[model samples]
Target: MSQTPGDPRHALPIRLNVDDSDSPADVVDALFLGRFANGEQPYSHSTSIERVKPGATLLPPAAEVVRAARDSDRSATLAQGEGWTLLVSRWSRGADVTVTAVSDELAEKVLREAVDGAQDEPEPQPENVTMGFWYVSPRRGPHRTTRQIAAGTWAEVRPNYTAPVAEAMDRLMKTTPDDIAGRLLLLHGPPGTGKTSALRTLARSWRDWCQVDCVLDPERLFNDVGYLMDIAIGEDEGTAKGRWRLLLLEDCDELIRGEARHTAGQALSRLLNLTDGLLGQGRNVLVGVTTNEDLERLHPAVVRPGRCLARIEVGRLTHRESVEWLGTEEGVSREGATLAELFALRRGSGPASVPAQHDGADAGLYL
Candidate 1:
């Protein structure tokens, strides 16, 4: 299926797998029945289906259509006529629609019905700021595969960093698009030191002008051209101020290290290429990488001066800071605590809450 230029939603053609014995219409009906078992009213008409997609309407390219289907916050409406079916699915990223029939005439008629039925439907409004993790879809190839995961906000993620590191972050957060020359932000720290938390704050602060999307699979992000292209070019926003996109890669220790040249091969090269090289040239995109590796061990090209807008080393909070964060009257004598430990401390007193530290270590996953 193709979308007209003036249309706010982009239509993606979804190929349905029909059994040899079952007709395509029957396969469509089966999808609705499955949803019904799950208490979803997927069907809306006498014999039609209408469901909600995630996210607002932002028509993405063909490569991003399927991702949009699974990620957008829009609705999916199915209207069928004899020998034809027209399906429209909206996603946080965009929309994915399917139109199928034995003949073009029937398909056209179904499409018109689907459109007319949706005329009075209110346009879905997505959250002003969204933070989510995306993974390559197993059903679709990397190019069109995207699944979104909800992420925390700055208020929810209370990151406690060293004064210097916190100051650097504050400066970066205050920097606007015109204040920077480079497009890369590298946050490196030990495990459980709130690197991901800092990234979340950045996303929340930049939400007005930036769209933050996490790449769940950093190993294949740059290695796969189709995936990289879909993320870099296919997902740019259509809004006047929401043109910028931040691609977050978490715990990518191997991709930026000195040995990455040989170990990660093209992955390292492609990452640098997107940082400041010609590949990143016209796109208003920024790359943020969180690694546990030291800067000294990273490729010189990756950490070279002027290559990054902000290079922050986020470490555990100081003794005093941790004491304040933990809300103790007197300062603790221990070295410090990671944000994870602090959060666990806050939760430990609650019902069914687990201890913050287990065996002298943070008791939760890092990022």
Candidate 2:
């Protein structure tokens, strides 16, 4: 972390003109005249990001910008205001904006006040069980842009699984970062077997203890330096719980397949590093990966017994489990059904009638 005498060259007066739809990135871009970098560390290494909290009025998108900056291993202050200073730094994962002030009051004032702009009212906070969704930017990668999905609770998820599997998932949800022995969580099974649905419930249940952010392009996560850096280092700015984060990487069979080391090269190694190697050390981050590949087919390093906190296979529900889930003793056969199929049936539609819905709309993964 470099600290200059708050040089005048870096002082930027804010001119905020945003509404509810605008993100903090938009605000920074509007003021800085370009995109604000994401995944940058703009604070001293000793500067504990855990203590940094966004004002209650700060929008989710803007909160992410600040979080990315503080999570970085380096520092770069871009501008300074009367009571606050703006930082733009790069992390191995991404870069982002940060506002630092001499006092919490000044920080809140600088965060909430928007000169030359209308005040965007804060969205009402939910009473209980709030879940947030984030995705990688298609054009710029995961660190660049993010949006919140609709809030949901575990009650909304209807994934049908065997009793033991369901109970295991519930236990995992209740487990905190402190309880896990390893940093990686591997959820694998056949497609449409409720892998994603169960992940949603886990995210909702663990919201209080950890910040769950998804890597939209899991295939690119290890291959792309920026994407990997962003997800691995970008701590959730909203969390006051020190360094707790959960990274969700779904449908990444190609990245962790048996032949990945021979084909994907460093991708597999990078994923492993994020799991429990040097990169994962000292960061209270957990990596959750979902794949359709069989457990035996995953890279040996990935499936090694001690390498994972939990290695659960999300198979399709059994005949009895499906009957209980569907509430049809005779209508549905005992062959069982996947969560997707059950969802389709619940909608009064056949399995084939499952609409080509986007990821989050039906499954609650996309916010």
Candidate 3:
């Protein structure tokens, strides 16, 4: 065992006998705990986890402090300084870097230095929105991935919506952080009405002030408490500390329908808690849901006054608007046409000639 000379209390040597059979995680744990075991040293300790930015590598400032380190394909590098031990574990998309130091200030300082130049920079295209996606993996449990998706401006796609829907969306598109009165944004209507398109535009419009994330397994999210908490408390990297986030759960007709209490069990309650109950108290998180169910079919608790920021029914365009959109009324119906139908018409395939519709249960496929 070799010990660095210092105040005897803080100079405890990290000496562990290793065997070939010892796992990498076991060794890493020993190294971290050996350096700063509780009550062994007179210094206070703190730890923090940082989600590394995409395309950024852990650099010199962090690497230079290392005394004893280890590396592997899935790596965990442990570094020691005067009174601190830092552990950085790299994963596929990001690294979880944690620092334990003598004081909260020192721990924070070390963490900041380690992650300072490691965040992804904002792209030049404002229409390209960065989105986080949450899902459960069979092997890894709950996980999140991020990507930059192109979402055109609301103005460019305004013609896809009916006049009334467009008017409502205009107000939503112009919303700033100060205008937030509720934490739920509900979009409900028939299929092929451009609900998904409107959400993409909303993401682009609110890119500056908000982060948007899609829960790929929304059904599992509400059912699993641990997964739900992970998402609720997970901070978005590359954004300001207090930035708002919109969690989009698409095609959640059953989760918010009138019989959700009976069908979804505690899922509905958990969803409501995330938006307005104790779980939502100090978090700047908003829940955005898209459903094909009509407004009357949704749960009253979900659409209650003061519970939602916006509840817009994104329906088909009116007959007049549909005629104008297609440049002729050739395939336009007297009632109206969905955005999907209009696109089909423009592509020389009228709605009537389109393939047979699937059972109504899977209407979100048109999105």
Q: Which candidate is the best by lDDT?
A: 3
Residue-by-residue lDDT tens digits, candidate 3, 92-195: 54666666777767767767777777855555576688888889976357877778877888879999889889999999999999999989999999878889
lDDT of 2: 0.60
Runs of candidate 2 exceeding 4 Å displacement: 1-159, 351-367
Better of 2 and 3 by TM-score: 3
lDDT of 3 at 304: 99
Tell me the TM-score of each prediction against the true structure: 0.66, 0.63, 0.70
Global CA lDDT of candidate 1, please? Answer: 0.61
TM-score of 1: 0.66
Residue 68 CA displacement from its true place in model 2, Å = 28
What ranges in model 3 sit over 4 Å off? 1-122, 352-366
**Tens digit per residue, CA lDDT, model 1, 64-151:** 2221122222454444444444455543433445555555554444444444433222343332345545567653354332232234
What is the C-alpha local distance difference test score of each model?
A: 0.61, 0.60, 0.78
Alpha-carbon shift of residue 360 in model 2 (angstroms): 9.8
